[model samples]
Target: MPRVSQAHLDARRQQIVDAARARFASHGFAHTSMADIIAESGLSNGAIYRYFTSKEQIVIAVCEQGTEALPKALTPEAVAGFLEYVRARARENRHAQLVAQIYAEAAVSPPLAAVVQRQLAAMRAAVAELVPESRRADAAAIAEAFVALCASYSQQLAIRGDLDPAPFTAALMAIIRE
Candidate 1:
C-alpha cells in the first residue's frame, strides 16, 4: 500500500466536510444522516468514519469552517475582499444556508451552542481590536456596530437570493469610512 501525503488527507477530509455542509444546509441537521453524507460525498462508510466519528463531529467541523480568523482591522478594502469571498462561496456552495443551518442546530444542541458562543466571543474580541485608541470611550459601542453590521449581512444574505454583493460591499465600505 502507498502512503498518502498530509495535504491529500486534509483535502479528503475537506471533501467530506463540504458534502456534509451541503447536506445539512439543504436538509436540516437532524434530518441529515451519515448515509446521506456518504451519498453526497460519494465516499464509503470507512472513508467517512476515518475522518469524523459521527454527525456531531462533522457538524463541529462545519462550524469551524464557517468561522474566519478576524483581522485586527476590517478596512474598506478588506470588506471588499470579504464580500467577494462571500459571493463566490454563495455562488458555488450555498454557503449562506450552511451557516444558517449551523446556527439553527446550535439553538437546540448544547455542544454546538458552546461552539457558537465561543466563536462569537472570539469575534467580539477581534472586533474590539479594530477600535481606535481615540474611540476608547465608545469602543464597546463601536465593536457592537461592527458586529451588528456583520450579523445584518449574514442574515440578509441567507434569505436574499439576488446574489448581489454591490449593496453589501457598499454598506461594509460605509462602516470602514466611519
Candidate 2:
C-alpha cells in the first residue's frame, strides 16, 4: 500500500473527532460509545482505533477543539458580537449543550478535568492579555470573571434556548469596562 500523506492522516483524525463531537453533542457523553463514534464517522472499527485508542481519548480531543481563540483586541462591541456568534453556533450545532455535558463529566473524571482546566487557563490568559495596561494588576482576576461570565452565557443558552444576548452582553460589557 502507498504511504498516506501527513495531511491525509490529519484529515482522517479530524474526521473522527468531528463525528465524535456530533454524537456527543446529540447524545450525552456517558451515553455515547466507541461503536457509535465508528458508525458516525462512516469508518470501520479498525480505522477509528487507528486514530484514537479509546473513547476517553476522543472525548479529550473534542474538548481540546472547544471555542475559537479570543480576539486580540477585545472591545465591548467585539464581545457582544462574539456572544451573539456563539449563541447562533450553539443553536445550529448544539455545541453549548455538549460543553455543559463535558463540564458534568469533568466533575467526575480526573484526566478530563485536567484538560478542561488547561483549556480554561489558556483562555483566561488570552483574555488577560487584551486587558488595558491600567488594569494589568487585576488582569488575572478580570480574565477569570470575564471567562466565567462568557461560559455562563453559553450555559444559559444551552438550557434556556434563544435568549437575548443583550442582557448577557450588557453584563460582559460591564466587566470589560469596569
Candidate 3:
C-alpha cells in the first residue's frame, strides 16, 4: 500500500472532527453516538476509531480547535465587531449551539470539564492581556466577566435563535468599560 502523506492523514482526521462537530451541534453530545459520527462522516468505523479512540477524545479535539476571537486591543469598536463576528458565525454554522452543548456536558463529565476549564483559563489570560493600563488593577476580574459574557452570548444564541447582537455587545461593553 502507498504511504499516505501527513497532510492526507490530517485531512482525514479533520473530516472526522467536522462530522462529529456537526452531529454534536445538532444532537446533544449524549445523544450523538459513535455510530452516528461514522454515518455522518461516511467513513468506516475503523477509520473513525483510528483517529479517535472514543467520542470523548473527538469532543476534546473539537473543543481544542475552538477559535480565539478576542480583540487585539480593548476598545468599544473592536469589542462590538467581535460580538458581531461571533453572531455571524453562530448563524452560519450553529457553532454557538455546539459550545452551549459542551458547557452543559462539562457540568457532569469531569474530563470534559477539565478541557473546558483549560480553554476558559487561556481565553481569560488572553483577554486580561488586552486590558488598558488604567484598568490593569481590575484586569483579572474584567477578563473573567468578559469571557463569561462571551459564553453567555453563545448560550443565548443557541437558545434564543438568531438575535440582534447589538444588545449583547452593549452589555459586554458595559462590563468591559466599567
Candidate 4:
C-alpha cells in the first residue's frame, strides 16, 4: 500500500463531507449514521474514520460548509441577496427542508447548537460590515430581525408547503431601508 499525500487526504475528507451533507439533508442528523455516510461516500469505514472521528463531527462540518457557502451565494452590493436565495430555494423546495431539520436537531444537540450559533454570528458580522459605522448597531438589529424572519418563513414553507416570499421580502426590505 502506498502513502497518500495531504492533498489526497483533504480531497477524501471533502468527499466525506459532501456525502454527509446529502445523507443528513435527506435522512436528518439523528437518523444518519456512520455506516450511512460510508455507504454514501463509497469510502471504507476505516478511511472515513481517518477523516472524522464521529457522525457529530461530520454534521458540524456540513453546517460549517453551509455557513461558508451561503455568503458566496450573495454579493455585498445586494444586502438582501441571502434573503433572495432563501426565497428562491423555498420556491424550489430544496435546502429549506434540510435547514429546518438541522435547526430542529440543533435544539437538542449541544455541539450542533454551538455550530449554528457561530454560523449566525458570522452571517451577522458580514451584514454588519456592509453598514456605515454610525449605523452598525441598528444594522445588527435589523440583521437579527432578518434572520428571524427568514427562519420563520422557512419553517412555514416546510410545514405548510405554501411559499410566498415576495411579500415577506418586500416587507423585510422596507424595514431595512427604514
Clashes of each: 0, 0, 0, 0
For residues 44-158, could you state the per-residue lDDT of candidate 1 as single tens digits?
9999999999999999988977885454466666665766676666667777777777888899889889998888877777777777676666666666776666656666677
Best by lDDT: 3
Compared with the true structure, what per-residue lDDT tens digits does model 3 show for residues 73-126? Answer: 667788878888888888988889999888887898789899899999999999
For model 2, what is the error of residue 42's alpha carbon versus the real structure, in angstroms, after optimal superposition?
A: 0.5
Model 3, residue 173: C-alpha shift (Å)? 2.2
* TM-scores, all models, native as reference: 0.79, 0.94, 0.95, 0.81
Give a tens-digit lDDT track for model 4, residues 102-171: 7887898899899899888877666556555555669888667766776777777767766656666676
RMSD in angstroms between candidate 1 and the native structure over all alpha carbons: 3.1
Give the lowest summed-lDDT range of ten residues in model 2: 67-76
Model 2 per-residue lDDT at 169:
73
Q: After superposition, how far is residue 85 of candidate 1 from its true place, in Å?
A: 3.0
lDDT of 2: 0.87
Taking all chains together, the TM-score of candidate 3 against the true structure is 0.95
Q: Superposing all C-alpha atoms, what RMSD in Å does each candidate have to the true structure?
A: 3.1, 1.3, 1.2, 3.3
Superior candidate under TM-score, 1 versus 4:
4
Instruction: Give the Cα lDDT of each candidate.
Output: 0.77, 0.87, 0.88, 0.74
lDDT of 3 at 55: 91
Model 1, runs deviating above 4 Å: 1-9, 69-74, 163-178
For 1-178, candidate 2 gives per-residue lDDT tens digits of: 9999999999999999999999999988988999999999999999999989999899999998885546556676788788888888889999789999989989988999999999899999999999989788888988999899888988998899887788877886677778
Model 2: what TM-score? 0.94
User: What's the distance in Å from true for residue 154, model 4?
Assistant: 3.3
